[model samples]
Target: MFGFGKKQDQPQSTIQSEFVEDVAPAAPQVTSVSSASTPSPLMSVSSITLPGAYLHPITKDNGIEYLFINENPMGVPAGKPKERMTGSFGPLPMRTNYDKLLYGTGAAYLTGFFGGGIYGAYRGLQIAQGNSFKIRYNSVLNSIGRHGPRISNSMGVLTMGWALLDNTIYSFRGVSDYYNHISAAFLAGAIFKSTAGVRPALIAGGLMTGVVGSYGLWEQFTSEKKETKIPSLAPAPAA
Candidate 1:
């Protein structure tokens, strides 16, 4: 037998092999969010601003009134004024209620002028077709029949003219931008009254008209502001 291969033996370590233990990661501790840190219950509000005009609505929560700028947290009240939040457009001053009322009434008056003209036209037509005609024997009186219908028509014409004047003069564009025109309407009303015998009811009506017009205009200025606050999910604050 030929000694072709000889086997070699290797020495093993005397220290016994120690097994490594597996460890798990510690779980994160959850913390509760406070109510004060969460959002409030109020919903979306609106705000608007224009040249020399500031419009916004007041919303109160928990006995505190908040004045929003554009109806959003975009402009929050860092502090309150010394007197009170009377009127302000966000960080700017807002128009008074009187102004708002005046704007609203002006719009109504303008609309009524057109309505009145239509009514006057209808009345003129009715009067002109009257079956009962009175003819006076007097030559002067007999000649006035033609003028009676003409007078009614003239009144209708006057009403139509007034409607046109109101449309042109008191329109939103005119009143908002043209202060001179606004003054002119008031002055004309006053000046014409003295010679024509100013009617107290008409004056009162005009004031009411202006007030309504101002309110309507004020409403248009406000735009909605959306908020992400969810009041229901928020927890109560600790005392």
Candidate 2:
């Protein structure tokens, strides 16, 4: 009973138990960077630029074309010729607005005077010899004939005065004066030839007058422009 009550000791090897805990190494952390993160050259610049043709299409080689560009471009217009203008001068004060008015009107009046005078004279002679109502129209015609050249000459003289003023104040040179005077003289010659009933002389004188008058006008027009004064438009300040 005593022996049975006493327990036998177990071998040291038989009582053994060990805890083996396996901790897997933390999975390798993989951080991925995208290639798209690289900046593009085009995205670096802030502004887009276009060529002139993009703004205004050009017509060349009988076809219209637009300018094409890739990448950022600096915008600049292509060289183009300017348009022509009308009237005697540009918006500048190189010449007065009506600088050429006197000369033009004078030329027209003179031409008409000579032409009318020749026609009136020829008709006058025909009416003077006839006892017809056409004679009544003759007096009216004669009145026009007598006054026509006179009015034309007077206009020429007045235009010459204006030309002198322009030439002096505006320094237009002798061009304006020459134009007015020569036009008057030629017109006077035409009238005289017509009054004398010289048909050939009338035609020749009228043609010559027109030619010389035209030449003088053209010369004045083509002459160099003179410096002109510009009137101020500014208002005076209050005192």
- What's model 1's TM-score? 0.23
Q: What is the C-alpha lDDT profile of model 1 across 4-88, one tens digit per residue?
A: 1111122212211111010122122111223344433442221111111011112211223455454334344345422221233
Total backbone clashes of candidate 1, pairs 3 or more residues apart or in separate chains:
20
Off by over 4 Å in 2: 1-50, 54-104, 107-132, 172-239
The deviation in Å at residue 210 for candidate 2 is 31
Report the poorest 10 consecutive residues by lDDT, candidate 2: 13-22
CA error at residue 137 for candidate 1, angstroms: 30
Leading candidate by TM-score: 2
Clashing pairs in 2: none
Taking the tens digit of each residue's C-alpha lDDT, what string does model 2 give over 1-239?
11211112333211111111112222322212224454345531212212222233232112344455622233333444222112332354423325454544565578667766765666566557566777756765885677677766655654444334434443443233444445444555555455567775567456656755675566457645523221211232222
Cα misplacement distance, residue 120 of candidate 2 (Å): 11
lDDT of each: 0.34, 0.43
**TM-score on alpha carbons, each prediction:** 0.23, 0.27
